[model samples]
Target: MAVPKRKTSKASKRTRRTHQKASSNAVSYDSVLGVYKRSHYISPDGYYKGRKVID
Candidate 1:
């Protein structure tokens, strides 16, 4: 079996894991509906890319 020869340091571990942190959601505001929604996703009122997709 393989094992680590030395103890891992906190600074080194934290530096490596910096990019592993959770990122904020990409939200955008809909001018027509006046609400915030995730980017590239259709609004709750059936509008996408600034056009009505459904009635």
Candidate 2:
């Protein structure tokens, strides 16, 4: 009896790499300013166009 070996593909490898890279740059909820966030809110980073001042 012969055992079959698992096969790997280039596309799968590329996808895995892309997924890893994306996961490495993921944001954490700890930085979220929930109290300041509103409907149609702009980020505190202040880089958005025509962002309304929260003050």
Candidate 3:
């Protein structure tokens, strides 16, 4: 009971969904602990690329 005998235009369904879009995680925006984070991790009061490595 299959279908789809040919009718998926729209640039081949957006080029096969181009990886299915919709993706996040990788924030990055903490000027010395001022907001957002996640890029290379390390910021929960520990800091990393912003110096002050735990301590």
Q: If scored against the real structure, what TM-score would every candidate get?
A: 0.75, 0.25, 0.28
Higher-ranked by lDDT: 1 or 3: 1
Per-residue lDDT of candidate 1, residues 3-40 (tens digit): 99999999999999989978899999888888888999
Estimate the Cα RMSD of every predicted model relative to the unseen true structure: 1.6, 10.1, 6.1
Ranking by TM-score: 1, 3, 2
Kindly report which residue pairs in candidate 2 clash with one another. none
Model 1 TM-score is 0.75
Tens-place lDDT per residue, model 3, 1-55, is 9999999999999998899778878797889878888898887788888898887
- Candidate 3 C-alpha RMSD relative to the actual structure: 6.1
Residue 14 displacement in candidate 2 (angstroms): 0.4
Clashes of each: 0, 0, 0
Model 2 agreement with the true structure over 1-55: per-residue lDDT tens digits? 9774877688887888885654333332323453433344456765223444554
Better of 2 and 3 by TM-score: 3
The top-ranked prediction according to TM-score is 1
List the candidate 3 regions with Cα displacement exceeding 4 Å: 1-8, 18-20, 26-36, 39-46, 49-55
Indicate the residue-level lDDT of 48 in model 1: 94
Pick out the ten consecutive residues of candidate 1 with the lowest summed lDDT.
Answer: 41-50
**Which residue pairs come into collision in candidate 1?**
none
